[model samples]
Target chain A: MDDVTETDLQAYVDGQLPEARRADVEAYLAARPEETSRLAAYRTQRDALRELHADVLAEPPPARLVHAAEGIRGAMRARLARWGLAAGWIVLGLAVGATAGWQLHAWNSPVARAAPGIARQAAVAHATYTPEVRHPVEVGADQEAHLVAWLSKRLGGSVRAPRLAGFPLVGGRLLPGESGPVAQFMYQNESGRRLTLYVRNEPGSGAETAFRYAREGKIGVFYWIDRSFGYALSGELEREELYAVASQVYRQLNP
Target chain B: MHAAEFVALIPRLRRYARALVGDRASADDLVQDTLERAWARFHLWQRGTDLRAWLFTVMHNVNANRARALRVHSEFDEDAPEAQFRPAENGLLELRDLERALADLPVEQREVLLLVALEDMSYTEAAATLGIPIGTVMSRLSRGRERLRVLMHGPQAAVRLKRVK
Candidate 1:
């Protein structure tokens, strides 16, 4: 028989001993009344401890704890959803890349020549507006016609908000550009992520219509100059997502 | 694991905390702090492992840090007034004696004993939860149980014998 050590006795009392070792400990205890009484006392102690806190197990947890748990679960689900959206964007980028080789070709061209100053201004406007909670734009999307008319009058050209899928127009605000007033139109998704479209009158600037990308810190700008006005889309989004949105803006404005 | 599943373990956590801290308000506060820390670092917890053990480990660290901070602020008194036995209104006198005895055990030994005895954790789980070796856990358990027995019965019997003598 294995030696009935103190550790084994403690384990035996806690009901953690192996079945084979249990018989050995029991046989060892049967002959020793002193050990038997000690083991009984240990058993009684365990029972008393359990009985002392038994009421706690039956009580319902507090409301604050339940709410905190629910909040965590909600945040986790939001993270997973964001990941899913990113995966979908990757797949869409591949499909867009297949047909949009012209855009990829333009990607290699000198983006500095396209209009670096406009890209910087657009990124600045994005950074300023995206963090606003109460008033993201000067005029809300509820007055879309009035907002379009007002911005068009300020920028000296008729500007239209692009109807990007999944990004609803939040509104527009006018800001001072290097040479003139610029119209900044904002859009927001369901998750509250904001994207801004900056339009400034570039009457004398060369009409280079190729879509170009520039990054200012974390903000990505996809800017292009059409006939009379320069349009730049800025957002804190993946390059592909910004590119996709910029493409929609170009198609809608040119069409 | 899902947050609801984590919430489901609260009763067990509360029971263990109550036994460890010996008070309702402080035990619930400990559990609340544990939940907050656990959620903030939820990504660190690997899936498919024992979540209960992970939580207990977090609670052990939280409690230890609090105890350390508390000791720094106040004198370490074994017989502090708060540690005095408050008999439950309807609880038996013997159980009240047991509570006092349990409270009187050294914190290390008491934690190990409660994990093994009240929480019904295996020696391995208690060791893992407390971040101590299994051998240390065994020694603490042996010492704790023996100390508890003496505290519960020895003093009274010895005083009676001394009076008769």
Candidate 2:
């Protein structure tokens, strides 16, 4: 009652003061008419300002803002579509021997996109494999050392074949990549479930990062960059199993 | 957020915009620029974060840049004869008293007051939007209100007693 402050009154108006303190302010104001008049004027000012601007909240949002956002999103979609079409043509040109060298360079081109590009590479790899029984791999798991050495030379970085003890190694090989040479190590579990480990160098800067996972079609890719080599383990394996492979790959390459 | 989701938040953005820029037209333009930038950088957004805050941050930065350009333009035009105003036929306020009172406030004080009182931002939100701390927001809001009250009523208090007698 003897020591009320302006801050306390302002906090009361702002509904920030605790209930007990607010009650004290209210009691003090009731006994002091001059203080109450001042408080009333403050409240009147607040109300008038609110009245002046509150209606704006209910008004329609300006069309220009909406159009501006739509325009940007539309442009992004268009740009992505154009890139997708060019990629499809190049990837198609690769399957035919006439444009193999040029198409191989296109495949090895370093362009980062959301999901579709990784999915396309994975689909192409899957189609090339799964059918080959005799020559699915150039260097099989029996020669793990030679396979790793050959891929390490082609990829221009140390390469290790991640051991999937639970899943038997079917075979492995090197392929022409979008950015450079690529490696695919195929594994199959007792249930006839097959998984592919895809490796390529990220085009350009070679900034290696951690494993990234994306599921495209029946295949799940756990991709990561370690020492400038990018690896993607693609399969229909469960998320836990995929992480298990990625963890082993991360450990061996990193260690 | 999608374009539709972002579009829905534009009214609140406009309120903040209008509070930032005194003129409605300029505020709308600032908001438009903010929305465009937000959409372009939408892919860069990490999932499950406060989109409203992100939008406000963009709007605040864009407004600051626009304000800088405006300040430069105003500086060069300061001595130009056309820079002086004759009252237009269609100013929204009838009583030039409140308008004069608002103009009398320093720009910083005026900005803090409009952001809090008109835009209804909590001190934390206002601080974040203004790129200041919550304590500063409270101090600015309180000081701005105190100044506005003095400007609006100090002369009137003296005049009122003289007329009553």
Candidate 3:
């Protein structure tokens, strides 16, 4: 009963055995000291290897990878702005040259600049607040009306709570903004993985709207500027899941 | 796959790259190259097939090309083989020591070993990923595991093998 071949034992260790052979393999292992020790060694080796590299998956992918996924959106936006200025100039029947000049100048000015990192900030806020066992959000989802009214009032706009598919509104909190007040909306799945929508009013964000993407570690953020408001959605999920949630938020707000 | 879906695989690719190259800089470069290559040829990737397995196949081919350019060969230390691999009484090898042993494994053995052990791929998946026969994958895994145990047990690990006359 102990004539187990080396490959058969290897298959057993690797979990490649048929159900019928499992008992025979177990019996063979029970009778053999040397083979048992080796199997123990193999399993331990596998565990150690996994432990050493498991952290890699936890950390975020680098910014270059994020930019690659974004597919030249920034470059295209910068180029399209000039043509847009020309079109807006003639369509609105304003001072075409002057408006075009101001638009071009505004593109260079601080009005178009939002300090380059609302996405990272959103990701950080989500990472910090989402894990809270007691106080994840300042105003719970139970106070949905009050939370929206207060946040919108403070930001001087309508800051609505988004209802994403498969993720209910868990709650929300008021976070200190880069300049003024910021509102963070938290949503959670059944598994406890959270998604956060961060919004704050930035006067310098200009009237231009752009969809931007950034990844911080395992977190993926789809952030955009719509007129004076900067909105971002952060989640640990991969692209497709996060995009679905982002689309929901965008539609709810624009509607 | 969508670009974002490709982005999601970056971490897994990076981890495998680090394991394969045994250095951070080279691994990062390898990952970047793999992503670029995958993106360029993403249309070729049929949907519904396992993305992870397909990615591993790409990585294996990329690694093969890189190794061929470097003219690298798997020349493991051959001073002692069967004698050094005999089971020892001690079972308390350090994890760090095991990692070092893993790095010392021959490249071919290490690849199959990691595909099976670290990545937990089935033998069929692993063979397809490496573009090798299932038998070759099994043999390499067997050799790799033995070598890793002996190395972790320390350089002089040995016990008498029983023989019947």
Chain A TM-score values, per prediction: 0.55, 0.51, 0.57
Instruction: Answer with 1 or 3, whichever has the higher TM-score.
Output: 3
Q: Which ten residues in a row have the lowest lDDT in candidate 1 chain A?
A: A106-115
User: What is the full ranking by lDDT, best candidate first?
Assistant: 1, 3, 2
What is the TM-score of candidate 1?
0.51
- Give the per-residue lDDT of model 3 (tens digit) for A132-194: 989898999999999999999998987788788888998888888778789999999899889
TM-score of each: 0.51, 0.48, 0.54
Higher-scoring candidate on lDDT, 1 or 2: 1
| CA deviation > 4 Å runs, candidate 3 | A68-255, B75-91, B155-165
What are the per-residue Cα lDDT tens digits for candidate 1 across A151-225? 988887788988988999999999998889999999999998889999999888544444556899999998767
Candidate 2: residue A206 Cα off by (Å): 14
Q: What lDDT does the true structure give each of the candidates?
A: 0.76, 0.64, 0.74
Better of 1 and 3 by DockQ: 3
| Error in Å for residue A59 of model 3 | 1.1
For candidate 2, the per-residue lDDT at A160 reads: 70
lDDT of 2 by residue, A1-255 (tens): 756666666666666677878778999889987667666655666666665545568997766666665454344454577678768777788656547777756654543453355446865796678567777778888888888898888888766777776777776788886667788888878887777777777666344432345676666766654445556777777866776776765666555
Model 2, which residues run further than 4 Å from truth?
A: A70-255, B37-49, B72-104, B154-165
Error in Å for residue A251 of model 2: 31
**What TM-score applies to chain A of candidate 1?**
0.55
